[model samples]
Target: MKTTITVNGEARALDLDTRVTLLDALREHLGLKGSKKGCDHGQCGACTVLVNGVRINACLSLAVMHDGDEVTTIEGIGTEAALHPLQQAFLTQDAFQCGYCTPGQICSAVGMLQEAAQNWPSQATEDLTAAIALTDAEIRERMSGNICRCSAYPQILAAIRDVAGEPA
Candidate 1:
């Protein structure tokens, strides 16, 4: 299958097998290794990436499915010279222990923040009509999909809160 996906602001034309997952395409084909393949299944949000500004598990999605779509991996979120706010917050808060899940965590956080900004409510939301508060519960609920095996939830929460402009 021939697929052209604009990844990290660059259009990449790849000739991949239909079975090639987005994760494999990014890591093996395009040499973008930030998005990890922790479980290969969608259960672990280790392969989360933004597709057209929406987050999805790249491991579970086929590369061909993303034809003509815009994808954003952790690399696209920020560069080494200039870290994304979330990335900086994660560092300031010491959010990761092993650092293996940091890429997915940051990518998911970017999408999660955008979703909250758009007034998207999570299960923690008390009032659907009210503005999103990004409360601790809200952040936890919204980020529940991405798990940190090191149990760095506190730091992760703090990092997210810092980025969300909430007092930690």
Candidate 2:
């Protein structure tokens, strides 16, 4: 199957098997290695990427399923010299220890921030109708999917809180 997915602000056309997962398509064909494949299963958020502005596990979805969709990998989030706010926060806050899960953590944080800005509710939310607060509990719950084996969770939560304009 041939499909075009807008990744990191560029349209990439590839002829691949429909069974190919988006994670494979990005890393193998597109050479976008920011999204890691920590676990082939969707249990880990290591393959998280933004599909049409929403975060999804690339490993869980087929490339063909997202034809013409806008996909944002960690590479698309910022340049090497100029990091995205979340990226910068992660750096200054030392949010990552091993750094393997940083890409997914950052990508998921980006989506989570967007969701919070839009007043979206998460499992940690107390009141659905009230303005969503960027609390540490909320951040933790929202970022629960991305596992940091190094256990730099406090720093990760701090980075997210900093980017979300909350106190550390």
lDDT of 2: 0.93
Cα error of candidate 1 at position 120, Å: 0.6
List, residue by residue over 1-168, the lDDT tens digit for candidate 2: 989999988999999998999999999999989899998898879999999999999999999999999999999998999899999999999988889999999999999999899999999999999999888999999999999999999999988888889754
What are the per-residue Cα lDDT tens digits for candidate 1 across 23-123?
99999999999999999989879899999999999999999999999999998988899999999999999999999889999999999999999999999
TM-score against truth, every candidate: 0.98, 0.97
lDDT of each: 0.94, 0.93
Give the Cα RMSD of candidate 1. Answer: 0.8
RMSD of each: 0.8, 0.9
**Root-mean-square deviation of candidate 2:** 0.9
Output the TM-score of candidate 2: 0.97
